[model samples]
Target chain A: MIWAVALSAGALVASGAYLALSRDALRAVVGVSLIGAGANLVVLSAGRLDAVMPAFVPEGASRLADGAANPLPQALVLTAIVIGFSLTCFALALVMTIRQRVGDTDSTGLRAAEPPAGADGLPAFPDDER
Target chain B: MNADLTSLVVVAPLLVPLAAAVASTVSAGRPRVQQAIGLGGAILLLGSALVLARAVAAAGQVRTALGGWDAPFAIEFVADGVGASLVVLAAVMGLTALLFQQDDTDPAPASPAFVPLVHAFLAGACGAFLTGDLFNLYVWFEVVLIASLGLLVLGKERRHLDGALTYFVLNVVGTLFVLVGVALVYAATGHLNYVAIAHATMADPYRVLPFVAVLSVGFLVKAGAFPLFAWLPATYHTLPAPALALFAALGTKVGVYALLRTGGAVFPTVAPLMSDLLGWVAVGTMVTGVLGAAYHWDIRRILAFHSISQVGYILLGIALGTPGGAQGALVFALHHSLVKGSLFLIAALVCREAGSYDLRHIGGLSSARPWLAALFLLQALSLVGIPPLSGFWAKFLVVRETLVLGHVVWAATALAVGALTLYSMLKIWLEAFWRAHPREDWQPPPGARPASAIAAAGLAAVTTAFGLWPEPVLRFTFMAATVLHTRP
Candidate 1:
C-alpha cells in the first residue's frame, strides 16, 4: 500500500514539474490536473488499505478496526476532484481566448505582450510620430 | 444571543455576496439592476461585519460546528476577534470598490460577467476567513482564483489579457501547492479540521514537516510574499481601475491573514522560526519592490511595484510573533487596505482627468483639479506615514514592536523602506501632477465622469476619518492580537 501511494505521488510530482516548465499552455493545464489527481490518491491511500468491506461495518465493529478504509479521505477526494475540474475548465477557456486573440499558444509568445520595461513617458502626437 | 450570532456573522458574509452575485448574473442584461444588486449586497456584508465585530468583542470567542457535524467530523465556523475583524475589512473594501464600479462611465458595456465574479470573490474572502477546515480553505482559495481571473480579464484589453494570464498561471501553481499540503495533512492525521489537525500535530510533531512546508508555500504565494510574488505587479497594474483597487485592498491581505491564523493556531511551535524567515523575506520584498518602483515612470506600475514593497512590512510585523508584533501587523494590514485602496482610486481619478497614467504624458493637473489633487495628496501622505494619518500610526506601531523585540536591524530596515516609499510617492507627484500640461488634443478619455472623481474623494475621506480616529481600529486590532496570542 505504501509503495502504491509513493508511486502515485512520484508520478504526480514529475508530471507537475514537467507541466510547470512546459511552454505549451494546454500541457501545463494537463500537468496541473495530473498533480491534483495524484494528490487525491495519496490522501485516499493514507487510510488503512485492508478494509475487508466498505466502511459500513456491522454492529460492534470497532471504530478503529485495523482493516476499515477511512471515509474521510474519500470525502476529501470528491471535493478535490470537483474543484480541480472547474479550474481546468476555466484555464482551458482562458487558453482558448489567448490562442484566438494573441495568435499563439506558447508561453514565450505570451511574454511578447508585456509592455517594455519603463516605457512610461508622454503619448506621442500623431504629427510627431512621422 | 451574541454567541448564537457567531454563526450568523460567519455565514451571512459569505451568503450575502453569493446571493447578490447570483442575482447580478441573472440581471446582467440590465446594467443598472446589476449595479444595484451588487452594491446592495456589498453594503449589507459590510454592515453585517461591523455587527459581528461588536458581538465578537463582547463575547471573546465563538464556534459553531457547521451542519452540526461536531468538531472533527463537521466543518466549523469559528469567530474569534481576529476573524471577525477581517470580515469587517473585506466588507468595507468590497463596498468601497463597488462605489467606484458604479460610477465608471466607460461606454464599454458592462461585462456580462462582472457582478457575479465580484460576488464570488467576496464570498471566497469571507469563506477563507471563517472556515475551520484546512481543505475547506483550499476550496475557498480556488473560488477566489476563479472569480478574480474572470473579473481580471472581463474587459478583454491587451494589457488585461497579459496580466490575467500571468496571474492565472501563478495562482494555479499556488493552489496546487496548497492541495499537496492538504493531502499530506490529511494523511498524517485522519482529520481535516484545523482544530483536530492542531491536536494531531501536537501529538506527532515530527510527522507533519512535509505538510507544513507545502501549506506555507501555497499561502505565501497567495499573499504575494517575497520570492513568490513575481505575478503581482504585472497583473495588478493591468486590471481596470476599480478592480485594481479591490485587488490592492484585499488580495495579499487574505494570504497574510491565512499565514497568521495557521502560524498562530495550528502550528505555534514553528512560528518563531517561520516568522524570522518571514522577516527576512519582508526586507527583501520591500527593497526589491522599491527598486522596481524607482525604475518605473508609469504611475500605475510604480504603485503596483510599491504594493509588493508595502506587503513586506506587514509580513515583518507578523514575523515577530510577539503580541506587540501581531498587534502592529493587524494595524498595518488594515491601514494598508484603506490607504492603498484610496491611492489606487486616486490613480484612477488621475487617469480620468489626465488622458494617461504614464507619468511623462500627465502634467499640471493640480491647478486644473485642486480637489482631485487634494485627495491624491491625502492618500499619498497617508501612505508615506505622514503625521496624524492612519499610515503613520501603523508604521509607528510596527517600528515600536520591532524595537521592543530588540531587532534593531529590522527596525532600521523598515524605517528605511518608509523613506523609500516617500521617494516613490514624490516621484508620482512630480511627474504626474506638477509637470507642464500636454497638448490641447491630449485630454482624459471622454466619459470620464465627475462621479468617479467623487468616488476617489470619498475613499480619501474614509482614509482620513480612520487616521483621525484610529481608536476604534486600534481597539479591534488589540482584541484580535489578544485572541491570537492567548492559547486556549
Candidate 2:
C-alpha cells in the first residue's frame, strides 16, 4: 500500500510539474492543483496504512484497539484540501481576468509587469511607449 | 491547568484579526465601518501582543495544547520572546498599513475587501509565529499567502496582475515544498510537533538530514535569498503603497523568523552542519540583491531589491548558528522591519509627489519637502548602518559576531555589502530627491499630503529612538536570543 501510494504521488507530481512549466497560465493552475492533491495523498498515507479499522474505540473503551487507523492525518488532509481548493479557485479567477484584460493566457505574452531587461546599464519598461 | 489564561492571551492576537476580518466583511458596504473595524482590530492585536510578550517573558514557554491534548499528540501554540517580539511588531506594521491607506483625496476609495484581507493576513502571520506544530505552520503560511494574494490584486490593473501572477506562482511552489518537507519530516520522526521533532531528529541526526534539507528550500525561496528571488523584484514594484509597506514590515521576515524558530528549537543539532553552506548563500544573496537594486532606476523596485539584501544580512546571523549570531539576527530583523517599512512608505510618498516611479522622471524633492528628504535620509542611512542609528548597532552586532566565529570571509562580505547598500541608498537620494527636476513642467501630483505621513514619521521616530536608546532594545533581543537557544 505504501509503495502504491508513493508511486502514484510521484506520477502525479511529475505530470503536474510538466503542466506547470507550460507558458499557458491555466495549464499552470491545473498543474498546481494536481500537485496539491498529491501532497494531500502523501500526508494521508503517512498516518499508517496497515490498519483497516476506523480510528475509534468501542463505546465504553478507553482507546482504539491495535491496528486501528490514525485519524490525525485525515484531519490534516481535509484541511489541506480546503485551503488548496480556495487557492486554486483564486488562480482560476485571476487567469480569467488576465485573459480578458491582456487577451493572452500565455505567460510569454504577460511581460507588462516585467519588461525585457534594458541595455547594459539602464532599465526599460514594456509599456514605456504609452 | 494553570496555562489556560496564558493560552487565551497567546491566541488573542490571532482571534482579534480574524474577528476584525469577519466584522469588516459583515459591514462591507460601509467603508467607514470597515476602516474602524480594521484599525480597532490592529489596536487590539497590539494589546494582546504586549500581554503575550510579558507573559512569555516571565514563563519560559506559554503552551496551549488544543482540545486538552498534550505536546506530541495535540496541535499547540507556543510563544516565547522571539515570537512575541514579532507578534508585537506585526501589530505595529498592521496599524501603520491601515494608517498609510487613510487619505481623503486618494482616487480609489478603500476597497471593502482590503481592510478585511489585511486583518486575515495578520492573523496568519501571528499564527505562523506562535504555532509549535510543524503542520500547523504550513496551514498558517497558506492563510498568509492567500490573504496577501487577495490584498495584492485588490484594485490593481493589468500590469500589476502580471506581477501578481509571478508572485503567486513562486509563493505557491514555495509552500508546496514546505508541505512536502513537513510530510517527509513526519515520516522520518513520526511526529509533527516542533519540540518532539527536535528530540527525534536530534537523537538520530542522520535520519533527518534529507528532510531538513528539503525543508530549507521553502525558507530560502520565501526569504527571497539569491537566485530564488527574481520573483520578488518582479512583483513588489507593482504593489500599491499600503501593500508594499505591509510586506516590507512583516512578510518576508516571516521566512527569516521561521528559520530562526525551527533551526534554534527543533533542529539545533543539525543546524551547524549547514552553517558553512548557509554562509555562502548569505554572501551570494547579499551581493546579488544589492547588485539587483543598483541596476534598477525606479524608486520602489530599488527598495524592493534592497529588501532582499536586508533579509540576507539577517540570514547571515542565523547562518552562523551561534547565540550571539541569533541575537544579532533578531535585533537586525526588528530594526530592519521598522527602517525598511518606513523607507518604503517614503518611497510611496515620493512616487505620489513626483508623478512617476521612474527615477529620471522625478527630482528636486529635497528642495520641495526638506522634512521628507530628511526623514528619507535618516532611515536610508540607518538602513546603510551609519553610527548613532538603529542599523549601525544591528550591523555591528552581526559582523562582530561573525568575526568572533573566525569566519573572516563572511565578516568581510557583511561589511562590503553594507558599503554597497549605502551606495544604493545614495543612488535613490540623488536621483529622486537631490538632483534638479528633469522637466520644468513637472510638479508633485496635485493633492494635499495625507496624515499618513505621520505614520512614516512615527516609524522613523521609533527607529531613531531605538538607535538613541540602544540598551533596552539590545537587552530585550539578547533575552530573546537566550530564550531561543535555551528552549528551541
Candidate 3:
C-alpha cells in the first residue's frame, strides 16, 4: 500500500513539473494545482496507512490505542487542501484577467510589466509606461 | 507578567491586525473609515508588540499553547527575543505604510479591499514570527501569500494582472515546497513543534539533513535569493508606493528570519554541514543582485534588486551559524527594513515631484525640492554603508565575522557588493536628482500633501537615530542572537 501511494505521488509530481514548465499560462496554473495535490498526498502518506483501529480512545480511557491511526497528518492535510484550493482558484482568476486584459495566454508573452528590448537593443517602453 | 496576561500579550500582535482586518472589511465602502480603522489597529498592534517585546526581554522567552493545551499537542506561539523584535518591526512597518497611504492622491481606484488585505498581510507576518510549529508556519506563509496576491491585483491594471500571475504561481510553488518539507520533517521526527524538533534532531542530525535542505530551499525561494528571484523584480514594480514599502520591509525578511530560526537555532548540528553551501549561495545572491541593479533604469527595479542584495548580507550572517553571525543577521534585517522602506517611500516622493519613475526622464530634484533631496541623500548614504549610518555598522559586523572565520573571499565579495551598491545609489543620484529633467515643460504635481514626506522623514529619522545611537539596537540583537543559539 505504501509503495503504491509513494509511486503515484512521485508520478503526479513529475507530471506537474512538466506541465508547469509549459509556455501556456493556463496549463502552468493547472500544473501548480496538480503539484499541490501531490504534495497533499505526500503529507497524507507520512502517517502509516496500515492502522487497524480508528484514531480514538475507548470510553473513559486515558489515551489512544497502539494501532490507532495518527490524526495530526489528517488535520495538516486538511489545512493544506483548503489553502491549495483557494490559491488555485485565485491563480485561475488571475489567468482569466490576464487573458482579457493582455490578449495573450502565453506565459512568455506576458511582458507588459517588463517590456522586451527594442530594435536598438535598448529596453523598450510599453505604450502605457509609468 | 502573569501567565494569562503573558499569553494575551504574546498573541496580541497577531490578533490586533486580524481584528482590524475584519473591521476594515466591514467598513469597506467608506475609505475614510477604513483608513481610520487601519491606522488605529496598526497603532494598537505597535503597542501590543512593545509590551510583548518587553515581557520577552525580561523573561528571556514567553510562550502559550492555544486553548490551554500542552505544548506537544496544541499549536504554540513562542516569542523569544528574536521573534519579539521582528513582531515589533512588523508593527512599525504596518503603521508607517498606513500613514503613507492615508492621504496619498494615488489611491487604488475602486479597490475597497486594499486596507483589509494590508491588515491580513500584517497578521500573517506576525503569526509566522511567533508560531512554534512548522505546519503553523506554513499556514502563516499561505496567509501572507494570499494577502500579497490580493494587494498586487488591487489596482487591476494590465501590469498588475501580469505581475500577479507570476507572483501567484511562483509563490504557490514555494509554499508547496515548504509543505512537503514540513511533512518530511514530521515523518522523521514525529513532532512539529520547534522545541520538539530540536530535541529530536539533536540525537541524530545526519538523518534529517535532506529534510532540512528541502526546507531551506523553499525559504530561499521566498527570500528572493539568487536564481529564484525573477518574480521579485517582475512583480514588486507593480505595487503602489505604500504597498511597495510594506512589502519591501517585511516580506523577504520573514523568510530570512525563518532561515535563521531553523538553521541557526532548531537544527544546530545540521547547520554546520550546510553552512559552506549557504555561504556560497549568499555570495552568488549578492553579486547577481547588485549586477541586476546596475542594469536597471527604473528606480523601483533598482531598489528591488538592492533589496535582494541586502538580503544576501543577512543570509551571509545566517550562513555563518555563530552567535556573532546571528547577531549581525538580526541587526542587518532590522536596519535594512527601516532604510529600504524609507528608500521606496522617497522614490514615491521623487515620482510625485519629478513626474516619472524612470530615472532617465526625471531629474533636477536637487534644485527644485531641496528637502527631498537631502532626505534621499541621507537614506541613500545609509544604504551604501557610509560612515556612522546603520548600514555601515551592519556591514561591519557581518564582514568582520566572515574575515574572522578565515573566509577571506566571502568577506571581500561582501565589500565589493558594497562598492557596487554605492555605484547604483550614485546612478539614482546623478540621474534623478542632479541631471536636468528630460522634458523642459515638466512641473511638480499640484495639491501634494506633506503627509508622504512626513512619513518618509519619520522612517529616515529612526534610521539615523539607530545609526547615531547603535548601542541599544546592538545590545538587543545581541541578546536575541543568544536566545536563538541556545535551545529551549
Which is superior by DockQ, 2 or 3?
3
Cα distance off (Å), candidate 1, residue A130 = 26
- Residue A120's lDDT within candidate 1 is 43
Q: How displaced is residue B89 in candidate 3, in Å?
A: 1.0
Best by DockQ: 3
DockQ of each candidate relative to the true complex: 0.36, 0.38, 0.45
Residue pairs with backbone overlap in model 2: B265-B488
Q: Write the per-residue lDDT of candidate 3 for residues B1-488, one digit (tens) a residue.
A: 67888789999999999999999999998988988999999999999999998888788889999886897878999998889999999999899888887665344443688789999999999999999999999999999999999899876777778888889878888888889999999999999999888989997999999998988888999999887888898888788778899999998987898999998777888889999999999999999999999998888889999999999999999999999999899889999999999999898888777866778778989988889899999999999999799999999999999988899999999999999999999999999999888889877777866778788999999999999999988888898899889866
Local accuracy of candidate 2 as per-residue lDDT tens digits, B182-287: 8888877889998888888877687788888878889888888887887888877666677778888888888888888877888888788888888888889889
- What is the alpha-carbon lDDT for the whole of candidate 2? 0.84
lDDT of 1 by residue, B321-435 (tens): 8777888888888888888887887887676577667787787877777777777888999998998998999999999999988989999998898899899999888877777
Scoring model 2 with DockQ, what do you get? 0.38
Order by lDDT, highest first:
3, 2, 1
- lDDT scores in order: 0.78, 0.84, 0.88
Sort by TM-score, best first: what order? Answer: 3, 2, 1
| Model 1: colliding residue pairs | A51-A67
